[model samples]
Target: MAAIWIAQETVDAAQGGDRQALESVLAGAQDQVHALARRILVDVEDAREATQEILILVLTKLSTFRGESAFSTWVYQIAVRYLVNAKKLRARDPGLTFEMFAADLENGLVADPPKAPDQDLLLNELRTSCTMAMLLCLTLDLRLAYVLGDIFELDHSEAATILEVTPAAFRKRLSRARSAVHAFTAQNCGLVNQSAPCSCPRRLPAAMASGRITLNDYPNSGEGADSFQAVKRRIGSVVDALKSYELFSAVPDHRCPDDIRHQLTEILSPNI
Candidate 1:
């Protein structure tokens, strides 16, 4: 039924200004539109906006589609264009904070990776790990590509079409995006800079929370070595937390799944 509605006959009639046919196409494509919006925008409100815009554009530009690709692909193509533009616009807005994004991230939820929808414990654990800030830094194009490729596990060629890029180009972008995401995760997880000043233990967060000493004090060379030790202890606490959580374990090796990591990133992201 869905395939029939989005087929060329329906699209042709809809483009001919047939309102009922247009509605049929929309009804049929609604799920696809929402899924694409959510994956690309990672925010419910943004997803809805993107979906609305995509539908409208599809309706308005139906005649321009020259049958170069599958109807679904064309629809996704339009959605991807809108999403890319939206991300750029949002990034420019100084008032839009990570908190807003995190809150909105829950919109247009899709099936989890590994098809574990019944695993509520895993989902809850992953939700807690969702970090919004890190997610935001993962450029708009990267997010689209990552979702289509990694989470949805689409092949390179298909993902490239969704991104409107050549397969090789898509692969390159995916590689870079994956690397950047890893670095972002490592920085937030405090694993890459094991010895760096910021790479301290998690216990120090308690000190930070208490405000016993200013963070600036640790950087001052003239400040007594005691202040430095306090910094070290704090750094240690962070490291210990990472170790305890086994955040650095190889993929599929740690108790915490990627879903959980994604969740943590979302939660801590707003604070950043």
Candidate 2:
């Protein structure tokens, strides 16, 4: 997916104290910021909260933006700084390890899982959740490197700028993250390795039983979506290592919740 860029004119107007321009700037940034937060933070609620706080920081710091970078880059710099530190505030335990995740994938899988009314949707939910859990296996710095450099497809220099690290340092971090993810998925994920034991269907029952596949709260649930089979067919030809990263790119882009604008407006009401 292409990165969303806010027009410099709009940013300028917002910085000049135009309320409508400010709203436009924030609206343009909301989804990308929320998506970054979602990728970095394991919990949906924590991501949402972090997005709000990050946007607020952007608004407050708008005057400090000197336009040395693209507006999106500047916003992302703020976001990464906040999210890297905010990991500690996450409600979910941040102790997930690759060994633990691999074991979880192998545990409680049913030979022939019963069908759900919306099996495709449920499976998609499980697949997205499982992939996200895999990300949690990485440490905060490595996870951010993978999310920005690999999953979001940001350029190494740009991603490094966002993280305030030297390009070589960022590359090293991304390399480590990629190796860990590739090693684990190549051994355990059916999508990457057809010989692997853990397929989405076989794991759906365990996911449902563990309350990790709730239908109503599915982050990627939408109409006219393809099943995992269709998704597999689309990316089946890619090399294994790239395919593991593509799994993340293939998941639908997550939108900021509907009430976010309203909530932002409420929070900024006194100033606006």
State the TM-score for model 2: 0.93
On a 0 to 100 scale, what is the lDDT of residue 106 in model 1? 29
- When summed lDDT is taken over every stretch of 10 residues in candidate 2, the lowest stretch is 217-226
TM-score of each: 0.52, 0.93
When summed lDDT is taken over every stretch of 10 residues in candidate 1, the lowest stretch is 248-257
Deviation (Å) of 105 in candidate 2:
1.2
Where model 1 places Cα greater than 4 Å from the true spot, the runs are 1-5, 91-134, 182-272
List model 2 lDDT by residue over 131-227, tens digit each: 8888889998999999999888998999999999999999999999999999998899888788889988899888888888886667644422667
lDDT string for model 1 (1-272, tens) is 02213778887876676666666666666656665555445454565556666766776677788878778778877877877676654664334333354343323333232333323333222322233223455666776776566545566887798787899989988777666655544544333345322322332333334453234332112212223234324435664334322231211211111232233233432332
- The clash numbers for all candidates, in the given order, read 27, 0
